[model samples]
Target: MNKKQKKVLTRIIIASVLMIILVLLPLEDYPLVRFILFMVPYFTVGYDILLKAFKGIKNKQVFDENFLMAIATVGAIALGEYTEGVAVMLFYQIGELFQSYAVGKSRRNISQLMDIRPDFANVMVDGVLEQVDPDDVEIGSEIVVQPGEKIPIDGVVIDGNATLDTAALTGESVPRTAKIGDEVISGCINMSGVLTIRTTKEFGESTVSKILDLVENASSKKSKPENFISKFARIYTPVVCYSALALAVIPPVVRLIMGIDPLWTQWVYRALTFLVISCPCALVISIPLTFFAGIGGASRAGVLVKGSNYLDALSRSKIVVMDKTGTLTKGVFEVTKVQAVDISEEELLEMTAMAEAFSNHPISRSLKEAYGKPIDTSLVSDVEEISGHGVKANVSGKVVQVGNEKLMNSIGVQVEDIVEPGTVIHVAIDGKYHGYILISDMLKEHSKEAIIGLKRAGISKTVMLTGDSKKVADLVAADLGLDEVCAELLPGDKVSKVEELLATKTDKEQLIFVGDGINDAPVLSRADIGVAMGALGSDAAIEAADVVLMDDDPSSIVKAIGISKKCMRIVYENIYFAIGIKVACLILGAVGIANMWIAIFADVGVMVLAVLNAIRALSVKKYK
Candidate 1:
């Protein structure tokens, strides 16, 4: 327990001992002396409550839980129920202690998940190892990460090989093998062997920093239910306070007017009990806690939710729209087939590779990788990239074009329509159609399972949006059993399509767009909930996305949705259980049928039960 909680516990123990002694003493004849003795222990365990009530009244912020607690216990003492008054405060303190401990436990769990922040990065400076802050390490600087040390910065492995413990980053227990030329993200522990890496991004832009930032600011964006509770409490507390006052005074006045005895003390005592039962502690505390636990649970499963608002929206998502490359498919392109019209296959490859050599697009890299030789950049000059079309470059003093069918037609070349189920790159040289290469990307092993999982989870429509050919998109969509497919779209067209889908969905439902490329950032931001494939996702897309899947597994998306639904269920349960019980007991308390013990159960007991239910949001194994 924290020091404050320990101190509160100590006070509770001391007060309980004193209260027991007071109850055993025969001080009925010396009422004044007995009152003074009881007051000593009463103030000891509950001074903070009274102090807070005073402060709230002074600040014109009355009618909070503290105020209600103070008024209820003080009124009990005034009615000569000193033992009940102290017991009420003691049990309330115990409940608060439980709440503090529970919240601290959940925060610690989240902190451990995000404990990947590096203390320092080891950089070789002037032939010596100098440990410096990761933020100070410049891009391209050689940093050495020894065995059992965290990879302090995102970079490329330049020397040595090791099995990386990526559980902290990806929540996968299996260790990943990293060798020279392989890209490694920050926050992963190097399990074995010393490794040298060339830093590629600054610390602020690294994966670890982005995740930490996401978690730290998550609470600022409250969910709809949380917002509703906040506003409800602001109005509910004041209205209840006035109702309690009316119960105390108006009932006695009505009895006097009806010629019956005005039992003022009895009605006042009932009003105090009514106030205790009406305290909104359960709804105020558990709703936000449920969402917090859900976020922590998702982080442990390698899914990071940026805010509770997204968590709430994800629970209501009925339509899931996803990008084709890197999201569902492995996004690794390979040259499956090459057709030559008027030249040999080697000549066609040479011209295509030379035109795409300077580009970093996955398809370009695949063509260059197929060529398997260094490009003579001197022969490839004046490279121009046409948006959504292809690349135009002067290859070997000949104007060569490498792109889609649109690019071939834009250059006034008569290109034959090739019906294929892969990303086709049409090549034209000196205004004549040369040939085409079919580069295909393999789908992720879990992509089909992920789609089925979403459908089983009650997603009404599964859509695939892509820039690939209609045949390739239709093939992937059919194989995955998607409800809709929109192909041959550029980045702008993607945002427009997302907007159209967004308009089609009901207000009660949300649309989720998942992507991984730099161009996907626009659509990611436009959708209701943007899910990014963080492992291979571009920084732009990650920054724009509301949720990030660290393992790049499409199946985790369904897991995330499940977590969201579970959290919302817990939240609503707490709200209903707390309010329903409070309202029932409030009615009984006003009618004088309930006493202090029953009031305590309605207030503190209900809060403790609600809190325990909120903790269930941390359980992800059930959803898995």
Candidate 2:
């Protein structure tokens, strides 16, 4: 508990004990003594609330919760309901204490998840290492990360190798091995060995900074449910207060004018009870707290939801359109089959690796990786890379061509057909077609489980959109049990397809598009809810997305959607329970069927129960 809450609890305990002692004494026989003893507990328990009420009145905020509570309790005391009044004030304070505790707990959870920022870095200056703030380290500086230290910036490794613990960023337990020439992201801990990384991005533009920004500002965007409650409270509080006033005076005035018993005190007491029962405290507090807890829980799992608005939209999503490469698939390619026409497999592999050594394309890297040995660049002469086609080189005094069918056909080399669903690189030696290397991208480990999880989470449709060949897209879709597949689409074509799907959405349905490419930016921005697979995605995708999956796992998407639906359900339950109980008790209180004790239950007791329900949003197992 905070200092203020601790002090309040102390005062409440002391006051309650003093009141109990005085009540057991013979003070009832002395009316003045009894009143003074009663006033002791009343002042002790309710002084803060009275002070807040006065402040609200002075500040022109007279219709606030504190004012309503103070008026109702004081009026109850005037009607000789001392015990009920004191009990009501004390319980209301306790409810406020509970709310403060829940807020503190949620803040702690979010802070722990966002504590991935590194303080300093070891920069190499004139061949000597110097410690400096991460922000002070410039781009292109060589930073040395020791064992057990977090990588301070996004960069490529120039030397050394190590195992990286990426759970802080990705929520994945698997430790990735980083070697020379591989990129290492910020906020990942180096588990073993040392690494010398050449920084390629500034500290402000690093992954950790971007993630922190997204999380810290998540609640600023309002969701529909939260907005509705806010608007309801603003109008409901004033209307109920004025109605309670009318209930107190109108009937008694009419009775007096008609020569009947006024029953002024009875009607006034009922009005006080009505005010206590009608306070909108429960609805105002619980609904937003539920959303805050939901957002915080998602952050702990490395999923950054931009706001509650997107959270609400994600909860209603029925059709989920996903990208294939880098999202459903691992995006890692390998040479699976090699077919030679005129030359052998060994000759084709050697020539392809030599020609691709100068290029940095993933396909080129896969071909070079297939060789699995050091290449003697002396054998590669006159190397030229042709954009959108392939590469040309001179190897061992023979002209070598390594490219696609277009590259071979352009050079008058007859290409043979291959029946694989991947990019085929044609190889020709001295203007003669030798062979082709068939490389395929592998599927992610959890792709199938993610699809199943989505179905279990009540998603009605699953689709895959990709720029890959029709055969490749269909194979992946079938393996994952997807309902629809659209392949070989350019970036603009993907946006048009998404628009058409959006047009078919009903009032109860939402369209969610997931992607991880710069080419997928337009579709990601055009969907009802855009989820970016952040791990391997381009910066453009992240900026245009509503939610970012830090781990790049498709299963996290299902978890996110499930959590959102559970949160929305909890929000509605709190709203209905709070408003329903309060309205029912308000009617009973005005008719004198219920007392001030019951009004206390309607105001504070209901608030505590609703808060407990809101905390359930933080528990993922409850939804699962």
Candidate 3:
């Protein structure tokens, strides 16, 4: 507990002891003395509530729980029920303490992420390393990270190597190996070796800052149930207060009109009990608490939800639309096979690698990597690149063409047909058809399990949308057991496809789109719930998505859905449970079958139980 909460707890204990001592004393013989003794504990535990109630009325905001509480307890005292009034205040304070502690515990879970904030960055200055505020670090400045320090900005490693503990950013315990020329983001702890990084992004625009911004501002966007309870409380409080007044006055007047003995105290007592039962504390406190705990739990699992509204939407998601590359596949091209016509396989790869050596495209890099030898650029000349086709250049006085079928057709080379589920790079030399090399993007680990987990988590359909070919898309879909696949689509077509999918689902069933590329940004924004792979995701995709999976693992998407499902379940359960108990108790209290003690349980006891259930949303380690 915080110091404030500890103090409140101490007050509760003191008030309870005083109540017990006064109960033991024989003060019933002296009514004034008995009232004075009960007032001691009452004021001790309830001073703040009374003060807040007075301030609320002064500010013309009288329709609140504090106002309701103040009126009920003070009315009980006026009716000579001092002990019951004091007991109600005592138990109410206990419920408030429980709520404060639960909120603190949830806040602590999220605050642990604040450790990701870098204290200082080590920058090279005049042949010496100097420590400065991370925010002051400029782009392009070379920074040095020690074995135990956090990387202060997003940058490429210029020298040295290290194992990075990415748990703070991704919640994965496996350390990542960072070597020369590898891009490393901020907030990763360098576990071994000293390294120098050339900053690619300023500190304010780094990954750490964006994540912190997302986590801190999440509560500003409340869910539908929370907003409903807020509105319900606003209208319910004043209406109940006037109804209690009618219960106290109208029935007594009716008795007098019928020439019957009017039991004013009996009617007034029932009215006070009604006011106590109508506090609305359980609904107002537990609904938002459940969502907050759920968001915290998702963060613990490496998923970052933008707000509770998105979390709510994810619970009802029936269809999941995913981009093929970078979302399921690794997006890294690898040379899988080579078929050379009349020439050695090594010779064809070397010529193609040399011709495309100047290009930094993934296919070009894969060709160079397959060749496994340095290219002699001096041997190549007259390089030409054809848009949407291929590249042509002269190598060793022979014209070499490397591209797709469109490039082969333009060069008048009739290449033999190949039925492969990977990208085929056609080759030609001096207008004759040579062989082709096959390249494919490998699927990520847990990609198949991610699809299965989604089905188990209650997702109805899983679809793949990609710019890849029909064969390659079908291969990935079959491998991962996806329900549908849309292949050979441009970015705009992907958005239109998502719109069509959106039209297929019911209004109650949300459609979620997951992607990790700049091309996927439009579709991500167009979906009902956008999920982005944050570790390797483009900034545009992350900004557009409603939720971010920090580990870039497809399994985290399933975990995100699971967390949302659990949270929404808790929210509804609390809503139904609290309202059900409260409405039942309110009717019983109005009929004089319940006393102030029963009213106290109906209000404080229900809040305590609801809060305990809400905190259950924060435990997701054992979940999928």
lDDT (CA) per prediction: 0.90, 0.86, 0.90
Whole-structure CA lDDT of model 2: 0.86
What TM-score should be assigned to candidate 2? 0.90
lDDT tens per residue, model 3, 1-624:
889999999999999999999989888899988988799899999999999999999999988889888999999999998889889999999999999999998889877854688899998889999999998988899999999999988999999999999887787889999999999988899999999999999888898888888878888898888889999998999899999999999999999999998899999999999999999999999999999898888877778899999999999999999998888988899999999998999999988998898889889999999999978999999999888998999999999999999899886777777877688999998888779999989889989999999999889999999998898898889989999999999999999999999999898999999998466879888999989875542477558889988887888888888889899999999999999999999999999999999999999999999999999998886345
Q: How close is candidate 3 to the true structure, as a TM-score?
A: 0.93
Clashing residue pairs in candidate 3, if any? none
TM per candidate comes to: 0.87, 0.90, 0.93
lDDT string, candidate 1, 40-111, tens digits:
889998999999999999999998999999998999899988888888888888889888999999999888
Best by TM-score: 3
Q: How accurate is candidate 1 locally (lDDT)?
A: 0.90
lDDT, candidate 1, at 137: 94
RMSD of each: 4.9, 3.2, 2.5
lDDT (10s digit) by residue, model 2, range 116-233: 8998899877888888999988899899999989898899999999999987677667999999999988989999999999999999989888888887788899999899998998
Runs with alpha carbons beyond 4 Å of true place in candidate 3 = 340-359, 376-402, 406-414, 427-434, 535-537, 622-624
